[model samples]
Target: MYFLSKELYFPPVDEASFEGVLAIGGDLSIDRLLLAYRNGIFPWFDEDDPILWWSPPERMVVVPSIYKVSKSMRNLLNQNKFSVTFNQNFREVILGCQQIERPGQNGTWLSDDFVASYTKLHEMGIAKSVEVWQNDELVGGLYGIDLGHIFCGESMFSKVPNASKIAFVTLIKYLKEHNYKLLDCQVHNDHLEKLGAIEISRETFMKVLKSEEINFSSSIQQHGR
Candidate 1:
């Protein structure tokens, strides 16, 4: 594996392993994280392990009309029981994502360093979050890096059934309304597949990410803040 230094760089995307690991180590500075996202790479590692960057051969992504919504979700949306907000309580959202248990995982990948780094990004307006609230309490939410044209989803959690789904549906609607191009899901999973996230070649994804300028200001505006 290619190891990184403080130089804020990465190996060529093609150099990534079959498993999609591109590099082994790097500090999660704002510069490095920004560069990594621009180049279609992202960090994923456990608390005790070194930072591992990845740019898989196949990427999971969704956009405006591409996501699938079940009839049950449509009914829930019509009910409007859950309220959605953006960039509100970002720290809490990330913490919730980390604490929510995954079926096959023993622990969270959102370590202290990762949380701290992403929090900084949120402060700098480079990251964004969507929260789901029911009866005036935070129930579920999702967070991601907002690259303007594409939103690179990191993690999400739901305390109630389909709370995360509600957050996701709301996000997709807002993105569609604002003409956002992609929602970078990172990897393929049954959950995402059911939501209509599909696999595309990494090369194709890179082209989409680099093709247009990211409208960060517009994304912020989409929140009506």
Candidate 2:
């Protein structure tokens, strides 16, 4: 592990050391944040902990077009009971995700600092959100960074059953409509796998990220209009 300083260039973190944590305790400046994402790294730490950057050895991702929609999920989609929208109430989406508790997580990782940093990114048009609604009520949604042809999904939460799924499906539909090629889910778990997320090598993931130059401004314009 290394102490990242404002002047020190980030080291080339080896995949083997990701388990040990490559860097710890750094301010979430725009430069640092952008550099991390560009290198396929991200910050994930609790409020009580210092900033911990991670780049897991095996990257989990999903190809937008091939996401698995189970029979039940398909039925729910067909029913159209829930309404979906984009970039609507982004703060609300982040707050909703923070309030919900995941099965294994001790508590919310979306701390105040995390929210503030990502909110700044959102303002810069690099981070975006997808929202799901039920009769004027906010039920579920997700937020992530747009890196070129890739959408690096961060977090999502559901107030009602299938709400998150709806948000995810809607976002992917929009991605496909706009010609996105990949949706990076970040890490693997049963939930993501069921939704068609698969594991890829970190090298491959970085290679793809390096090859693309995303224009988030255009996507934001298209989405808002």
TM-score winner: 1
- Compose the digit string of candidate 1's lDDT tens values, residues 1-225: 798877877889999999999999888888999999999999988878998999998888775644557798899999988999999899999999988888989898888878899999999998899999999999999999998888999989999998999988889888888878888899989998887677777876787788844343343245332
Whole-model Cα lDDT of every candidate shown, in order: 0.86, 0.79
lDDT at position 104, candidate 1? 85
Q: For model 1, where is the 10-residue window of minimal lDDT?
A: 216-225
Model 1 TM-score, 2 decimals: 0.91
Regions of candidate 2 where Cα sits further than 4 Å from its true position: 15-20, 212-225
Clashing pairs in 2: 148-214
Which ten-residue region of model 2 has the weakest summed lDDT?
216-225
Error of 2 at 193 (Å): 0.9
